[model samples]
Target chain A: MNMKLETIETDVLVIGAGPAGSTAAKHAAMGGAEVLLVDKKSEIGTPKRCAEGVSKNGLEKLGIKPSHRWIAAEMDRVRLVSPSGIDVWLNQENVHLPETGYNLERKVFDKHMAMDAARAGSQIMVKTLAKELTLKDDYVLVKAESMGNHIEIKSKIVIGADGPESRVGRWAGLKSTSKPKNMESGVQFEMVGVELEDTRAVEFYFGSVAPGGYAWIFPKGDDIANVGLGIINSMTSKNAYHHLLDFVRECKATQKAVSVEFNVGGIPVGGPLNEFVTDNVMLVGDAAGQVNPLTGGGIISGMQAGLIAGEVAANAINEGNCSLENLKEYETRWVEENSLSFQKYLKAKEYLLSLSNEELDSIARAFQGSDFERIGPMELLGKLVKVSPKAMVKLGKIF
Target chain B: MIISEFCMYCGECAGVCPRNLIEVGENTLKFGQKPCKNCQICIQVCPVSALEVEG
Candidate 1:
């Protein structure tokens, strides 16, 4: 046995220091629990993986005000480019962007959230990689390597905010339900010299170019943007990176863009895991797959879920009952708060995935200048019926 | 073993490779100086059937 290892105890242990993990740590500590948060990265959000867009109102609903330090740009409008290159402009009251979305400087944003959690009295350790964990019914023991030292942490409950791989959740023996079809492969380039139509509008391109997924151009300034695309795993026999390069070469705006940084990663399109809580373990964030399928957004939902999980975790520790039944409250509450929108959007994703390039073009043209603020399934189907009844019929059945 | 054209750039293969022999690059995969022991977990975990072993 290694006796030089340090042992610490806390009421809650959060793995990963991403936005979700920090939020969970903050709330749990505020609820009077001794919380410890850890991440393998030296910095929480370096080498950015996301397109860094957040719904303004959605952040407000979570009580988060975008700090100017991390707000790259504020967007009040968006344009959806169809396969045929027809543009559909959507503003407030019409699309998911709803009121507005903010392009973020994630490095600053993640550090701010993590610092906030530390201020709330949550102990944080960076460069700590969780290697193994054991559940002992009443408590859990997490084995990790910090810097060059071995450490053991004992906690009443563990919140798995680790991203898609979710080593902590898997170590706790929680089963996830993500399917191959429920995930996407994404590649992005933060490029300079990309022109923006509107300084406040992000653009989305939908067509065969992305193959069951979509491409995005979110501007950070008048001349710089994060240009990216996600492709369904089953879409083609070619590398997703190649498709993104093709996009950079083909798009008028990004054609001459000079790449500043590159990011490649997996995106979960699944709504949520069925059983996220095990004895003494509560899963949060990407570990629970809380990303919205249709929008391919995870940060807002993950933070919200983390908030709920932290409160529930502290309660379980206080109640001295970390049973699965007690932890089920987190699951029930998150589902209640998110199920309606998430499920509806997931169904919409399925409907959208079934469409072909031609059908997608027709749908985009039908919604051109749809003066409406927002559209529901029935309204969209009604419009599509005029353009392509065949698509309408298939979509109606799916919806 | 060889990688096919279906590499999606998800980079999961590089994470699971025991020998740390793979590096995901801007447009192509980079191999380390060491020879691969053919751990094949990269093949098993690939979602798109991009990796294959020659008979």
Candidate 2:
């Protein structure tokens, strides 16, 4: 490939305008820096792949109001089903927020966010792809392609908001790879004509049905719902779609239903990245492994990271110091705020994935009738240890 | 350049544009004529209306 033939300049350049990139761009621009945000898709939110679940608290932090056009439904409760189909209902009374979750129209949500960043004065470029990053003498060179033409942008600072399969971080000299076993392949479908109550609840099914992972039903509305499942990559003996199909067939509502849409994607279960920053670049959101280890939710964490990266980048730019030492502040802020939760969740995830069907059932039985307190990762791990100390002892090895 | 609300801040257009004429901000997206050659390539592939050619 010919080296980039076109050249540009910016105070800050952010890649992969997903949740993280948008957040970074928004905050960075608000901080008074000239920012450029870009994405490769023809539409901001087309080819939807996420289950579109975000915590209520997460949305508020971003100053985003839940619009009906973007919100499929409100989730106030969660039902955890064991291997034998024993249901444990966790009500709103147990959680801090009354409305705990939002079922999102990701396409709309993503697009609106990008627009918000634009409204904040950041320039956004769509349908452009970042091919690589070159470290110039004092700045970074972003090589890209647009409409079959080459382009390059020089910037003092760069943010990588790219997704799990990010090449930006790798190209920027950061270790951004994930192990196969630490990844989960997922399949989701929007089914219409299904008869279901219009309750704001999310459901989880664990057992051989989902194997290594679980299945979920997030109601979009009274008649439409997102029925999806994720299985660990190690359990790829069977296709993810086949598992989703089997779950759909088993669902009483899905019988005689027509499919309105289908989506397939992968979730990184590898926990957070070991490092999220380097000299001139920072990684945020999925690229930084900000998704929850238990539920595979990243909107909240991604937004959180974006907020921090934005502030840090803006500060660095204002100070006229854009170096690895300065950018490391973003890393510190993120780790100080979320490292504990992330580490604990990562441990719990490892333990959960290694449990047998019988073990899962036993643990569920132990937790039955218990008050559904909001349990942190360590608390959840402690419960597992209390239930089976031997298993907990073995967990130490896996972690 | 004109940016539509559909832009997602991917930064690809700014990264690859010949003139580098894009800047995405919080709550708003904007662009400046910072050496833009008006190659019109950015207008061709913006995944959303976030980018457009200016006369």
Candidate 1 residue A220 Cα shift, in angstroms, is 1.1
lDDT of 2 by residue, A1-399 (tens): 666377889988988778789989999999998999988766887767678888887788778787887887888888777877666778766754322488888888888889988998999888787766887766899987665677898998899987765667777777766554555666788888766543577788887777667888888877788888887634645656778888899876578667898775556667778888987799998878777777787888888899889889988999998888998888898889878877767776666777777877888888777675767646766887887776566565443
Q: Write the per-residue lDDT of candidate 1 for residues A17-53, one digit (tens) a residue.
A: 8889999999999888999999877777875778999
| Cα deviation of B21, candidate 1, in Å | 16
Candidate maximizing TM-score: 1
- Looking at candidate 1, what is the lDDT of residue A201? 82
Candidate 1, superposed: residue stretches over 4 Å from native: A1-3, A96-100, A374-379, A390-399, B1-55
lDDT of each: 0.79, 0.74
Candidate fnat values, all: 0.07, 0.00
- By DockQ, who's the top model here? 1
Off by over 4 Å in 2: A1-4, A96-100, A365-399, B1-55
Cα error, residue A251 of model 2, in Å, equals: 2.5
TM-score of chain A of 1: 0.95
